[model samples]
Target chain A: MREGTGLPAVDLGTTEMLEPGTALLIPTETSGYQEDIGLFRAETGSYYALDDECPHEVASLSEGWIEGEEIECPLHSSRFCLPDGRVLCLPAVRDARTHRIEVREDRVLLYPGTAATRT
Target chain B: MSIESILVIGGGLAGFTVAQNLRARGYAGALSIIDPAGIPYDRPPLSKAYLLGQKDTAGIALAPAEWYAEHRVELIRGTVRKLDTEYLGVELADGRRVHADRLVLATGGSPRPLPIPGGDLETVLALRNKEDADVLREKTTPGMRLVIVGAGLIGAEVASSARTLGAEVTLIDPVDPPLVPAVGQALARRLHAMHLDAGITLVHGTPVDISKTTHGHSLILDDGRSIDCDEVLVGIGIVPNTALAQAAGLETENGMLVDENQRTSNPLIYAVGDMARTRNPDGSLERRGEHWEYAMNTGATAAAAILEQELPVHGASWFWSDRHGTHVEGVGDMNGVGATVLRLAGEDPIAAFHLAEDGRMLGAASIDGGLTIRAARRIIDRGIIVPPESLADPGIALKKLAR
Candidate 1:
């Protein structure tokens, strides 16, 4: 898992607020989304969040394109499968660090690190 | 008989892909691989991290030793001296003959040697396998004057790696605007500039002579310019190992000729990777594709054909090269395709999509925009027609146009 700032989980937005094939960029500091975490809404209505930085290069996943259950990095086009964050292509030999995301009512909450357990 | 036993000659990616994909597709046959190298490792990193001392040889193995044993795949470390197609067996250098129901040739290729004066000097080197890379790595020290005699992917990558190590690099090639044939004039110009900006001396000329100098060596170019250096690294190209195939009476041209199914002249024998020249869909012999993806795809194609399984639809040809810390990729047949459209303007992650006359996407190339090339690859494979305006727009998701 990537070394996070160890910040507490934050309430992102509503389930309806993020449509399928949409990704929201969240930064570590509230200065402006320079890309810290990428919260993605898969076409299958599943929500996945991962480190915004691509493991292959320094591309932000928030600026990448959503392809079904995978996210293609805009910079190097490395594909990471959702939920597990396992790399599905070359250039990126390692998997991306996936974060836990849960929907409470219409709000989406994100927990950093490898623990994807529900509280 | 349903291939009860198989013998794969080579431990490279192509050999591994065939063995693994066959097993994944439920091949319960007796499998064995005869590789000159003891372990099956990746070759791409030889010019990058592996050469820079950032990664060790063990880290490059495709799979752990336990994985092969667990999968019941026999790995034999020996060189195949000849292919006995008469009995579908291979003659090993140790006078051992291994017979199999199906035989696959994944012999791969070797670096083409420079045929100039003083080309065989001890300091002159070419990288192909791990052993070659190890020697190159030892020579790449700070202040080492390196003269590279090609601007192709391998040469360029070596130059980048050498430069990163604080070595003085002079890259020379006969072609003007390096990589223009593959990535087009505009992108090649950007790459040429990048090489120059990184303090590498890029010379557009062919080497006519290589002689020993007091410092190390001196390479005289066709344009009469001379470069004095500590070592000469030649990365011109590769020549496929076809002697074994030819000895077995297999058809050979650019490489061991194979049908679309990866079947050689003999129905029981197949060839893949840099050694196999496949027949195109149009019934013409394809110039062998030596990239990693082509090797993997051909391996898979051979496995599916052997298993009598439904062949997966072949996608657009794809390849990636990393130099100067940027990943550059090209997908599909850029040369055989129609006009090209620049998706992103300016520098850095520039992308271009080649479209047929009827507006169908045929291929794509990108600097750091692998995602764009990924999307365009599907468009090419599926014969998707996308409006030029939509493709030019960065906001528009290229994958959405697939449907």
Candidate 2:
């Protein structure tokens, strides 16, 4: 229901190609990869991308430990999921965002809202 | 019945703030608030400015009766006995039920009682809310012997406030060096000296053996020294009101377990204030914060989360007290910190800063105008490291703590 849910996609030509099991964090509008928290290979061999920066404090999820789909921030250790971006911890009441990615031929491009606005 | 209405229970500081914010933020659905205690009132001033007659109870209320009606906020009067999540409602004590789409548990907490004998019979008093202050105020007579248990922030402040009202006060606690629970033992001792200088008798490393009397009460010490007192005041600590959460099958630790958004086990429910102990980022359970600023900030944070809105990052934890006309404020925990910088603002003010090993502010203590403590609070939250020279120079107002 927020503004700019359906925006035109730009052609992200040739870049480093990641396998279906692995994810790459490319810069998105207003959002960043935050840290190098590689990616999660789902049961269906799908990759989910997320911002390693916690929505709560200055804690980085890349430095923190990961469990299943959830990555905990090392600073405050607030847990956020890579799939739907749901928060599962205290002191962090906001949810981190998951970028919609389009893997064409070999390049990976991140789209802000490939689906609905979860902001 | 399907609930499209939110019922905020307990019209204390937390409850009113939640309702006030929801309306301000454009929540147009049915909003209700519950309070058996009548209009929303403030308890912070009751212990300090109110007792000193600096401010009256009327000045402290968050909401008057008319404000609720103006906002179309349904203010209910009665005790909310049980909460049923499946039914999407709360059951009143009188067998009535209030329907709600969401629930906010803001019951607050009760004061910790003296662990001594005869504590049950009111030989001593514990203060957490406004009612406790009213009872203690009535009993405080001129030149009455008052043996206060616990020399922590509450105990010391109460002692200081009671002393101003003409009571011979003796503060009893087990802190060999006071303020040990907050700042380390060494720093607590330094502040303990301040209490002693204020003419308060500190019975450190010992507790009072309270006994009831025909007239009033008598505290028998371990050394066989009995101090006859008209009354006793306990400032040990507090316990959160978490029974409602536990009864509703919500997870609870020292208080109700809440996520960063202050959400309980159920997503439809949220808890805040003293009764809700949220886990820190380190996976440690942190509860029992009694500061007014912390309460207001945390309460606001929880309210925002419930609306699924982005909350401004939580600032550092803070505790403030006014003792014997002296203002004492602390930011962050100083026990794990080191290298306290002592500075004096002119000849009238004093400031002390506790720095973490990494040079970030761990905590700050100040006297006189409370400007430095306010500034230091912002600095600690942002993890700003002030230069040692800046800290040492009394010319530098702690306003530099705000990054």
Candidate 3:
């Protein structure tokens, strides 16, 4: 509920409305998703990670929003999985590197192995 | 010890530019930037392209990692809680304290929140930070109704983005044509056409009184008509984040009062961007300046202040908005513009300008004027006054002022 602009970060851990069994695929700051860096808040604590860059074309995955573990590219409807980096839709076939995460005190700390997530 | 290390508080355009220009100006020093827990990102697009899904945060990356390392700027990830002027340091929310020889409080402004009825939870949203945009984005369904409570630049940009996202947008404003506070009524009226043509419901001359309804809330207009809405967006104004500087005993008004050099009451600390209620040639202090370029230019001015270098005289303010496929620009302060002039590439595609009664031109807004905008900006920024005839003849360059 912050006035967060650009892909601002929303920690799923911060809200109670996020129910279990459903997953939230959030964008990390490493990807530079501007406003709410998509927060993946799974009530079950099960989450998925993917490159915010859409493998198809140049559309940023951060622009493309998340539905379940599948994130829809905002430009084209290129869908990809948060876990295991698989493309479920067309125009995007490359798998994005899964960002390593450690839930530190309910806050997700992203470990960029190469620290090369563009944004 | 000489001020060699700089800690810039706030990673918006100003903060980033201060760091960027420091490198560009050949000043090498230990640099650190503290923002609220996100990679440094550009914000102008949040109200437009980002909102329209045209771009994401990555698209507007100001500095990549290589740039940061090459420039030697450490990116501190959090909000600044307290600034110890005596210690020449800042305390971040994460409990990490950093010290610098000089501190630049670029802690821009926050969105002005409404304190009126129906302003409680489940009904309202503000577009300031990265999270707020996502909140609105998540809530906006294909047919979700959005009532935009203001018709200013940010509000209008959000309106355009919402409409593009397939949401039904209703912009309610008490002012006629909107943007009168920034751009005068004449230019505001012309821009109004662009909004209406983009499928937005424009309610003018009517103040909306928000009240709780069975479903979310309702904005009851002064005309006695009520519109049911899924959510309310108030972009009416902004509140400067002057508390940080104020807490440290720096002069503060509606914004942190600063001199033309961007030096605040304490010369040891400098303030830039909107947070600095900078003095004008007219002897008045500007509480706010909402342009991206102004932030960049002002940052450079503050850097000059830090270096004790001669600074450039203030130029005409320039700003742009890309909403609903239209790119509108204003050169010079639109606040003083009075007389109106409409230009056209052809008989159909048009743009407009405004000037005061004394023929002192004030503002300009163009729609797809292309490079013509480049020419117009030069004319306005350099104070080149063009005659009415040259405007009609597109062949002449906008710089021919004396003739």
Which candidate comes out best when scored by DockQ?
A: 1
How far out, in Å, is residue A1 in model 3? 48
Top-lDDT candidate index: 1
- Which segments of model 1 are wrong by more than 4 Å? A1-10, A24-38, A50-65, A72-80, A85-98, A114-119, B280-283, B343-349, B390-403
Candidate 2 per-residue lDDT, tens place, B1-403, comes to 4436888888877777788777766777898888887787767667765665665666556655687788989889999889898997899999999988898888888776656567666546887767778788888777887888888887887888888888788888775776755644444665667767777777854554677788788877767777777888877778788888899899998888887787888988988777877866677886556666556666788767767778957667766566765556666766663777767555432666788778988887665533566567668877777886797687665554453
Task: Give candidate 3 misplaced runs (Cα > 4 Å).
Answer: A1-119, B120-123, B181-186, B205-208, B211-215, B280-283, B334-338, B344-349, B355-360, B393-403
Which window of ten consecutive residues has the lowest lDDT sum in model 2 chain B? Answer: B343-352
Position B272, candidate 1: lDDT: 88
- DockQ (C-alpha) of model 1? 0.31
- lDDT per residue as tens, model 2, A27-60: 4433333333334433344445555566654444
- Candidate 2: residue B96 Cα off by (Å): 1.8
Better candidate by lDDT, 1 or 2: 1
**CA lDDT, candidate 1, residue B8:** 91
- Tens digits of per-residue lDDT for model 1 on B258-350? 988899989999998998998777878767898888888899899999898888677888888889988888888666557877766534438
| Candidate 2 local Cα displacement, residue B22, angstroms | 1.2
lDDT of each: 0.83, 0.69, 0.68
Candidate 3 docking class: incorrect
Q: Give the fraction of reference interface contacts each candidate recovers.
A: 0.31, 0.00, 0.00
